[model samples]
Target: MKTFVKIMLAATIVLVAGLWFSNSFKALNNQADALEQPTEVIEQPIIEKTKIEPVKKTPFSETIVVETAIKFEAPLYWAVNDYGLIDGYSSTEELIEKYYLEFTEEQLARLFTEDFFYNEADGVHVTASASPNLIQTDRDFTITELNENQYQVSQVLYTLDDGETAYIFVDYIYDEVNNNWNIAMINYQY
Candidate 1:
């Protein structure tokens, strides 16, 4: 009789636990439904507006695209090869690259810009008994390098094609937006 009573008690406990779990699950379901179905937000409206303007458009055929070919983007330059090196070996190549990257054609013109510095040391003399003509000397200079601090160049006064050459130096200032080197002053002609 005692064994029967113990079995009955165990069965009752199991049934009660199952019922409680089912009712708890139902209560959770009720909460989810109540949260999902909102009690407000009755209506919304639809409206439209359009505005137009006129402008001239150029034809695609006539459009020209000019892209600057920066062989090396500086700092960590030549990291990803955008411009292929033809033979991959250049000694004077660096100087040539500097000219394109550091100076514009317009900036190059400024080197030849004529304005007397008035300060005797900075001005030029055309005729001197012991010296070569400064005008002819300048005409001989060919652009070799454009740098953030200086312009490295060559001056060949005697021979146009094959002459004794001297490096012409121009002082420079660096431009940030253009990332360019500009002539600040022609400090030395060496």
Candidate 2:
């Protein structure tokens, strides 16, 4: 009776293991079949290309041609008094000889206008320093034409070792009689 009981217990365990293995195998096969099945593909929409037209010009539109000339820079200079200080220039003649050599007669006359200087008799008075030092060697200047008879001259002056900048703006008007550029106005950046 004892041997029969032991054999019955071992048989029950083997039967349970066989059923579990069979169920696991069936589940694995079902998963494989789901992956192997065919799927429906969706189609993409087609796009059409459009042609571009060139822009047309109207008869009222007129293109003006501008002629740009080479830009020339006037040399940087200091206005010093008779004692070699930056107080006031010695005389109008000295000022003209040093700085206004390129200026036309009309331009020179414009310099004496009542609004041009603080002291007309003294000419240019710069009481800032004894003398201006050149901070950089290269400088840039531009002259643009506002119209056929007028031009604008602009220059940037970097002076002294302290990196100071002085801007000079001058307007030149073309004299039909002389056919040359004449200074109409002169301003400093301060």
Candidate 3:
């Protein structure tokens, strides 16, 4: 949506600028015709009256250019809250629940996967044992907000007992085509 809005804004500005330049050129041409004489090119008076000396214009002046209003892509901040953890995915069941809602047709087209356990959700729960039980688990993941229409995620894995840990950045793509969020892809160990 942000991209769409930006493209629209650019197109509108270009159209307006084109119209303005066209009108200005037409007016300038009309004025030139009315003058009925070649335009005069006058050199600046280089002699300062008080100094009474002709000083050559210095060519050392520098210029500064600034863009005041144009905006680039907004910063990619995580949609997650504090502590760098998604507060909800504490167990296998919870993870499954979160994953299922996230894979609907309203959400599937945007998602990609590398896991061996690929399954579909059709508004009903599939076989219970087939899905990973939300066993006692702890994982780390990064959630980044890529605009109103996109998000990227990285996964972090942790052990259950000894506090040993490993890191993974699972890339996720978010889409808004079905008026909802969907996964685009996931590289679990990336």
Candidate 4:
């Protein structure tokens, strides 16, 4: 009777386990089937389209003409080359003639030494062709006397097209006969 009871208990446990495994397998199969089936996609409702009007362009002939008066003060010092482009005043004479600098011919002659135009090995040659690009028409210069006969004139000069500014130094010598100063040397450092 004990052996029969043990066999019946073991059979009942096996039967319960089999039923559990079968139920789990059935659940997985159902999930797999659900995944394999085609999904139904719900269509989104379409929005109503609004009509857009094209922009009308003004005709050249019928366009409104609005004239604005713009007052521009002419540069105190200005010159033009043969080609009509804005050019720099080349000489001390030109500077005076264009009202850029206030100096007389006798004063200029005394101040600008022949060696003033000399190009040192390290200094840039301030020639007529190179003059236009060296300094802007609107720059102001500061002149300070160093000694009895020597003066230092300095200015922040700018390049015409490039808009580059440089510190320019001009050493001048006072001539008693002419009663004015002359440029002894000139150089610029950027």
- Give candidate 3 regions above 4 Å deviation: 1-140, 146-148, 159-165, 168-172
For residues 72-181, could you state the per-residue lDDT of candidate 1 as single tens digits?
A: 11211321233322222232233234433354444433332212101122222112123222313214344433533344433443433455444434344445555544
Of 1 and 2, the candidate ranking higher by lDDT: 2
Give the per-residue lDDT of model 3 (tens digit) for 133-188.
Answer: 11112333345666654555544554447666544432223334334344344333
lDDT of residue 30 for candidate 2: 94
Which ten contiguous residues of candidate 1 have the minimum total lDDT? Answer: 60-69
Candidate 2 runs further than 4 Å off: 1-102, 105-138, 159-165
Model 4 alpha-carbon drift over 4 Å, by segment? 1-137, 159-165
TM-score of each: 0.22, 0.31, 0.25, 0.29
- Candidate that would win on lDDT: 2
Instruction: List the global CA lDDT of all models.
Output: 0.39, 0.49, 0.38, 0.46
**For model 1, what is the error of residue 116's alpha carbon versus the real structure, in angstroms, after optimal superposition?**
5.8
Off-target runs (Cα >4 Å) in candidate 1 are: 1-34, 38-138, 146-150, 154-168
* CA RMSD of each candidate after superposition: 18.0, 19.9, 28.2, 24.6
Question: Model 4, range 4-103, lDDT digits (tens) per residue?
Answer: 9999999999999999999999999999999999999999999999989654432211011110000000221233433322344444344334432222
lDDT of 2 at 112: 43
Ranking by lDDT: 2, 4, 1, 3
